[model samples]
Target chain A: MKDHEAVIVGVADAPLINGKVAQPGSALQIVARCAKAALDEAGLTLGDVDGLFTAGMWGIPGVGQLPTVTLSEFLGIRPVVHDGTNIGGSAFEAHLGHAALAIEQGLCDVALIVYGSAQRSEMSRNLAGRPATLTMQFETPWGLPTPVGGYALAAMRHMHEYGTTREHLAEIAVAARAWAGLNPAATKRDPITVDDVLAAPTISKPLGLLDCCLVTDGGGAIVVTRASHAKAQGLKPIHVRGHGQAATHWTIAAMPDLARLTAAEMASERAFAMAGVTHDAIDLVEVYDSFTITTLLTLEALGFAERGGGGEFVSNGRIAPGGAFPLNTNGGGLSYAHPGMYGIFLLIEAVRQMRGEVEPERQIANVRTALVHGTGGTLSSGATCILSLD
Target chain B: MTKPHPVVDPGTAPYWAALKEKRLILKSCRACGQAHFYPREICPHCYSDDLDWIEAKGTGEIYSYTVAVRPAGQAFEADAPYTIAIVTLDEGPRMMTRIVAADADAVEIGKKVTVRFVEEDDLVLPFFALGGA
Candidate 1:
């Protein structure tokens, strides 16, 4: 299959507040702000945005229905091409491919992909408070924690089958915090150690508080256009080299293998093949880190390390500062703000790194290529994209 | 005192109904000769509507599990530090349920288990205990 060539022209992130307590704002307001900032970064206005793509309302109260249509109308632009592909956190990464293909096929010119959430400020009581549904009929009745418990199951299985220990998982958190320390925009920048991660209170077995990503209130947006169009607009173009997405199951019960993430394997392979680059050539990796275990599994699934060797791969200060492989330079979801869906932020950070927009302390010097990956829905779905400066 | 119960939908009503009789059943796809849990009308493997409810021996092995040191929600508060597991049925299907043992930590991967009916209020739910326990 011939790869569609589109370029990321602009990327912007909304101000991420700790918002530990429920804040007083809506998803629409935050998303609109992010969209405008991204457009301004690209030197484009609402009139130039012919394509608009977004995910669901993310359970924000009074956001109305249909987030894509609602956000478009709110922005005062009627996009000829629109998409609302909600595949959990990987939605925005998947949209990159969707928008790139649309742009290549002349379906739209400047595609704006946006996401925002106030999950931390809204609190769990206001959001995700629903009556018993299908999941309740099967899994939740057994007290399966929606995500933490679901991910813990996978972590337990990995430990059982691969001898992955808690310390190895803690290494990921420690490394993420180290990276976050250098990022001014990161919500949690305090230095932490593997011991701190292990000592934190356990939300689920093998998953402590430190291992989890912070529930933050934030938004992010990206603009994609044809490579030629980006050059014409005089914007720094980060070429969308390749992209792929896949899902194994919806519920944790149906996950084919708890120890392995097949979707990530499939998606990364397709992406690597499309980008025509091996793991050695990529300068940085930005992976979704919902939990420390999530980052480990993604690394293994993406072939950064051997299948069960993800634990060993992240150990010995490998992913930390000055490590050979720079993982999640912008602190990632673990240390950075994770407002519900974090896929868009992955692209934003990748673009920053490629464009040399980050601080010298945090940026990877002369970064030419970046691989951004997102996992959603209990490690059931995965999306991979390779972006390059050349 | 009451416990959490499964919400019976049109697709899963029969599975819950069979539990009342202390019998375990799952939808077996006649077309693909496969079985699945959390019953649906169509076959997940082959997408065939040609299916039938078959009695299962209720014997399986613990595929994976986690000991919830903390309750997942309010209803499970009483069961704090309980064991939840995905049991791979002998009939070739997986189901999520609790592992009832004297020590939740004793539950290990690949441990053999069999279904045991626990009654909470008017609802009967299938839980798993160590095989031969």
Candidate 2:
């Protein structure tokens, strides 16, 4: 590795659910706290952060004005690099990649990546008044509404040809919940069985309540710096060896295929090739769980399992702790608070696992490398990053 | 006539208007002779600005398909189990539309279909159904 490969040395995640932390904070406050914690974990102060990377085009559009601006003002330091990407949820991974390239060029020593949102409230408010949810406002008129509905439509097609079933989809959620049970900060910690998931309330046909992810207001962050800088500062650096992104079509309606996420598959292929690792070589996996079927389908797309065999591979307690593979150990978006920012959480969990600070039981043994994937906007955009310890 | 049903953007107004009134429209480059749908101003195949809207025979085959077993969002809960297919039009462009005369069970890849307009808000949307049916 070069002296300045973008390396994530330290990471800190704000507790997802309300507990010992201060009660009732907005998404901005959550972002500030998480950013603060990430810097602190690196044994650095706010003043040490030279660059700030923000995700999603939202919460603010005009330059020099971001919710990050308020946080920056509170710290009394202007950032040299302010990157705000609006690719739905894939912005963080994209930001991290961009940050890495910038760090290689001596842009900044410490890059702060943070995101938080009140998607639960925003979605509810929009649905109560608007004819369609904001996500589905355009396609819903043509009868494509909600992420689950869109994905369920795709999953149903998979079932038609590949015989994938609700049980197969449920197995993904069940495995996620089992991993969540071992997490202290998970919003839904109790274990769930495939049968329990299948019997859960139906949000959409074949995709019951359990198949969908949670929606809550929360934030998470990861701090990156040149490897040598972090090493000179006495922090262990997780090398950014692999990163790539792919998008098939802007709208789901125009895509040539539905049963598989071709973009995610392509992105993962690029990432693994960049990282020089195979599916079996990866010790930890963090597949985005916007919906249960997403995980199942992504597992297959990422080559973790064969086509239509995700259900077979994930069933029978195979993905939980002590199982074949450890996935979404931070509870994922399903059990973890989704907070409208899934990419940030995936990197955060990967960092925590690699740092070896997670609660012991939830921690996967001998995790030298991790694969973190993110999906944005009805699987319209996707990117994957491989974080490895050398 | 001006395009109706909200496909009236500067780039695609002509295409949507052509799709209406029973015309399958595609952007045919006068210089390149390429045909495509969900029309864009520049040809993805040749990047040409010289293009015209040409009427199609409204015949195509299913490239791929999905069944919406779960009705999601607020507007689609009533339309559960609808078949949405990405049909490869005879003009060589693929479009997303609901396929009629084919149930969730009957839909298959490469199945022939023909464009049929469905009216919404005084707007005619080009839908499709089994070609023989």
Candidate 3:
């Protein structure tokens, strides 16, 4: 097989809470558990794996063990490409691209992309204290603590620039909760109404309680397969029609347009080009919902709706089950789980949709082509992958 | 030491110190024509070593903003229901700061805002109140 033709034959996840994981940051315990689950789901053992990629932990202080090295020692598997990146959740997709490149280069056969964080767990060292690296050292000294504040700033700007309302943002949380009602695994499965979303507490002003995500302890993983090998091995093959990634801005202030993410647009364009399908061809979307605003922005950027119209589209129930473009079927970061690298969860849910394995009530019909988006670092990084089944 | 030590590192001491003086500053990259807040050692764009800190004009538009109803972390307990906004400075860069003087309904996008300092956690935070006020 030539380069860039690798497929994703197996996928799985640990879970998420408020777009965060439950591990105690770099526990190594969560990563191991999620990786094992993914390998098992793929019908492959640790010995069958030859590559690894992991990301999104302020957990480890300063350890140099990549998953391929550490897991080989822990799970006892060895491979050439060992990637441990921290670009927020989008790093997993970046890892998949690298794994695809490795397979295309004949560097490795099976690449395991893994991410887990105990973000919500106790004994978590980083949230209170600053990590060795943070995009906010200079800015936060003005007192920017966590990423919620960073995005809150953007949410405010979106409201000021467009006529985006608090009610509009509420629609996102309401819709996600509506979807989560059917998904037992989602953290907030109580079935919240828009009024409930509006009345809920506020995390940052303009972004309410429902606007923010849960920060829980969990992990997620995916197995990128070589298309040729999967066909011969009789594994369910999901074609990665196209892939696109862009990380041009270094800081939130550096963005050309903070109200909208240009990177999501660039990624979706490239992914659609590779998939050989237009937005009209996509039956379901699994966009990262780190916040309600993220979904609204990505939806507009992906052309699912017009800019500033995401709130209306979401309010109309277009993205809910039986809608034109069902999203984050596994309850998303709001209802299902966020566990940090939400991108991994997006991939996992998309694969399940394509495989026709999604629970009947939650499944979006005719899911031949799907859009999976991952965001990293407070919308600082982004990746888009288009997948389809033959 | 009390809680929230906020150990001022080598790269960010100046900006924090200036904020203590009720003065706002930003890092301008000579290599690329971009003004960036949250100063890093290198340019966020070009990664050039050529970077310098300059005082901001203290006037910017509320690019976007929101008020917090819930307190986050220990640092903001007293500041719940306070305004947090991203202000697009006159220099063409956006900076995050809290908003004061205006209630949520009074705040609008593209509204003019000005910088003021709020002392908390042994750090003087830059916040924006309604500009004309």
Candidate 4:
């Protein structure tokens, strides 16, 4: 292993509510538990952590402003490097790339990336219009739905131009539910069908209730260090092969194209190029599923399917469990849990799948390479990371 | 609950003030010869401060839209199932507004639309109706 190569030696999620360790607590408390577990898995302690990366919507005015400082103070470890980048849900995936560069540059030795949210527990998530301030003034005053409406616009455009149907979108939800059925931690695992998706109440036109991700209380963490250091610690090192991140626009109106995810295309191209691997070489895939359209557009953006070909590609159970392609094995945010920011959980599940730590039913056999991509905002930002068990 | 209204600031004060007189205006960048919505002091296209206001045709085609079957919030419960749309103006810039139609089916992509001003409290919000000019 290269001495300067960054490797992830530890990954963990906060106490699971439905799966295990159902400890009810604040967002901070949940992250503390998750961080402890990840560090313990790495055979390290807070004293050894010199770098900290964290992001969230939990403590906006006070804790969120200085998220890393709050976490460092609570964890009782002061490090030379710290980053608190909140680019919506993709912030954690972006953190993974930032942490890798920091580790490679010798900025810090032990890096910890963590996120926690209690939106569900606190009932903080509501179908409310964003305040008509700043860039949102043009949107909120029109009573445009916060997020679903933006995605619906994309879906409508995709359908109008590419002959995609609501049924095609339902296939993604059906596939996610099938995967969730095999996941013990999945929030909704009743095994829904395409009809169920179509029958669900429409939150916004073209996007039903089932089309949206679950709003659950959850937290996750990851520990990264040099590959050489990981070997010295007697832990298996999952190499950070490549990572890339990009943002197109904050508001949906400003998005360059309603039918395409330009940020994801840009982000994955850089990541795939840096990793020196093709899409066919990837053994497993995990992507942010904030909405069903999110997964579909990301699949196209990631090159799994041709542009305007995602609807046909995702049809016929291609990405379902026991299907041709393995995707969102942990049920994704759609069926698993989305506590506001879902990127951290994507990394956690990717690391687990690579380490073969997931339930046998959902585990992909012999995963040598995994690609995890996170989409944040209203299809406004994207971050991609490639992990290899080399 | 009252619906959300735009908070006018110095940079956007002129645009909002013009709306009171039912005049639709946009910030036209002299440097880049481009027009943009939600007025700004500097040109977004050229990053130049040499910007001026120009009256817009306020006619465009629906680039995309969503009918909010569910209200955005409590304030919009009465207005559920309203169509929110991005209309590409004839002047070549897109803006977010509501598309008011006699029937919901009248809203669709490529449908020609013209701007309509509605007085809400102290603000006049620009919405669109299904028609050209």
Candidate 5:
């Protein structure tokens, strides 16, 4: 069998509804819009897309099962290959590798991956009456604060074990906002200081409101095809140089180590090995920042910084604009839009940076390669992808 | 407002039932000698169905924790600023629980804790408090 490579030919995002408490649209509407825009960007129509990959419908209540099938029918396309890989926020990143392999094996040529969320509009009601899953049964009874509490627990442990301070976490929020200032589409653009982050009301201890991602309504899509097919279509190809995915545990309680993200270590190691590149060779990084602790842990786990040194590594304006490492140039989930699942946007931004299609002020000069990392399911799942224009 | 209660399913019914009697029990795999929390039908480590329920002394150390300054949902609104923690059991497994009968700020990692049962709407949920207290 020939070792075929898959390339990302097109990427697009639905119009971001920023700062609004609610977006007046259904999840399907947002997803369809983004899917159409992505297909148009690829200079292809729905008919050309032979595969459809999306997260499962179980994430949102009343969204029923077989979301990919529903989406395919709604878009009026009969796909030969379809998948609903539900790994939470990292599901879209997981799709990248799956679609690439499917294209490589000739199972499908064009794959469209997409995600959309109306979380902001659904937050109050969803939180009021969350369904009883295993996590809810075990942890909720004790008043565990759902998502924020779990990540905060990890943060507390990190701080206890390494003496990480709130100032260190605030630096992440401040840097992210600085990057957001350069992105006109970002939801929050106001410059903030470390003191401002610390002063923000606390949601969970050791993680204030500023440490969390913005709740907005948005969706993103990506189109992948064989490198030869992209060349035939005259599309600029962003080569998928390497990809890896792994999970450490299903729930926060089961995590082997609270202070470490072992899955991210394994995932990034496999990805870097496959791409034949080291951390220094990468031009830029796009890491998932569901919370400040997530980014800090990912950096340490991916070997970008020494364990327990992530706090120091991010200090001194190192990750902000005009810094050595241009991290989360799209403002990340912190200042950027986070519509529940944020992995797809990480890939979209990486492709944009690799193609040099972003704002001139934020674009990395002579950008040839980018690494995108995503965490899902309370940091239970991780996916890493390396992309290069070469 | 009504507080959140456990939705005891068949696999975990035994564990919750035992808790109702003020007993803390965890599943131990006979094949691998590993104990796990949030009762499951099969062992997570060895995937063996041969399991036994062992009474735990309920003494443990605080592995990690956070104080919720804001309520996660309406059910927890009255309990804002509560301390939620993962306690590493003496039996070699960890469980998601809360620390009560103490100030939230005073809850520290590595502090010894013991399981305490709290009655909530006819359900007895296990929580951890300072061991010596």
Candidate 6:
């Protein structure tokens, strides 16, 4: 690796008791705890951090305006390099790329990317808090549930055009639960069959409760530095091979195509080109699973399956544990802790898999390369990263 | 609980006003000759500020839809299981709106639809119904 090549040195998730934040949980407190733990694992202190990156839906109205400033003041570390790019859930994946660019350009040597959310504890996970303003004014007044309704609409279109079924969508949830059964940190571990998924109360038509992600409180952080620095410190580094992020539109109606995730296609194409890797070379895959349709669309858009073929691609235990493909191995947002924005958890799991740090049964064997993707908003934004242990 | 009311601004005022008059209007770009929704002064199609408002036929097709078995919040509890849909208007721009039908099965992709006006307090909202309804 080049001397200034960026590599991840440490990663950690904030403490969770039964997948919920232990009381006294605030977004700031959780983020700070994760930041400190990640730094400590890297054998560095807050003083060593020259770059700080964060994105979240916390301290609403204020942090929405000045997230970097809020985090800097609370963490008590003022950095010359800081970024607060909030493009919804995938913000941290974008931040990782930004941090890598800063490191390679010598703008900063050490970068800390962090995120935290107490959406469950605060009881703010629903659409109740949203106001009818701007683009939302058109959607909210109609009683359309934010996010979930948006995804269901996409599911309806996909089914109409390609003959996708609730059974095909249920496979995704079953796969996630199977993985969750092996993960102690996962919020839901009970084995669920496709029939169970279909039988669950429908949140929105075409999407049952099992088709949605779990809501909890959680935080995560990643520490990045040059490969040369990590080598000198005798740390095993996970190379940040490539990253790309893109967005089409914020509202579901404005999406260029309801059946396809155009942003994921753009983001993953760039990431794969940069990494010089093919789809077959990837040992593991982790993508945002805010909903089952999100995962189905992402699989097709990422080129693992042909457009409209995700239903066939993920069928019959294809992505479950000991299956042909390993996906969302941390149980994913479907069965893992969702805590509102779920992009940060994707990175955390990818890094752990690369380092062989996960529980024995859950770890994939001979895993050398991994791909992580995050989808944010109502199928709005996509950010992809390719990481390697080589 | 009352459902949310659209927060209107100068750019969207005319569209809402037309709805109050029981007519649907769309901003059509004179340059590209393509129409758009949510009423923007600048045409998203060709970046032309030359735009005109035209009366929509109020007839469309259900591009996609979802029945909110659990409503958004208390404001919509009474309307639980209401159908939320995206209708591809005859003018070509797709819009987010409610699909009002006595039977949930009446709503489906590709179904012909037409708009109806519902007045709530000071506001008039546009909702769709199956053409057969």
* Candidate with maximal DockQ: 4
lDDT tens digits, residue span A121-197, model 2: 44532311123233222244455445555666566667767878888788778778877788878888888888898
Model 1 accuracy (lDDT, Cα):
0.85
Query: Model 2 reaches what TM-score against the true structure?
Result: 0.86
Question: What TM-scores do the predictions have?
Answer: 0.95, 0.86, 0.87, 0.98, 0.96, 0.98
Question: For residues B4-99, could you state the per-residue lDDT of candidate 3 as single tens digits?
Answer: 434567777887788888888889998997888777788877899899988888898877665655544566556556666677888877776667
Chain B TM-scores across candidates: 0.91, 0.84, 0.83, 0.94, 0.93, 0.94
Query: Model 3 in CAPRI terms: which quality?
Result: acceptable
Q: Candidate 5: which stretches are off by over 4 Å? A: A1-4, A17-24, A56-63, A121-130
Better by TM-score, candidate 6 or 5: 6
Cα lDDT listed for each candidate: 0.85, 0.72, 0.72, 0.89, 0.85, 0.90
Model 1 error, position B72 (Å): 2.7
Q: Report the alpha-carbon TM-score of model 6 versus the true structure.
A: 0.98
lDDT of 4 at B85: 89
Q: Looking at candidate 5, what is the lDDT of residue A137? A: 77
Q: For candidate 3, what is the DockQ?
A: 0.39
Better of 2 and 5 by lDDT: 5
Candidate 5 chain A least-lDDT 10 residues: A123-132
Candidate 6 chain B lowest-lDDT run of ten: B99-108
Q: Residue B58 deviation, candidate 5, in Å?
A: 1.0
**Separate DockQ for every predicted complex:** 0.59, 0.24, 0.39, 0.84, 0.68, 0.79
Tens digit of per-residue lDDT, candidate 3, span A256-340: 6767878888888888887788977888888888888888888888888887677677776767766766788887887777655
lDDT score of model 3? 0.72
Name the TM-score of candidate 1: 0.95
Root mean square deviation (Cα) for candidate 6: 1.3
Task: Report, for all candidates in order, the number of backbone clashes.
Answer: 2, 1, 30, 1, 0, 0
List residue ranges in candidate 2 displaced over 4 A. A1-3, A18-22, A57-76, A121-140, A201-205, B1-7, B29-34, B61-85, B99-113, B130-133
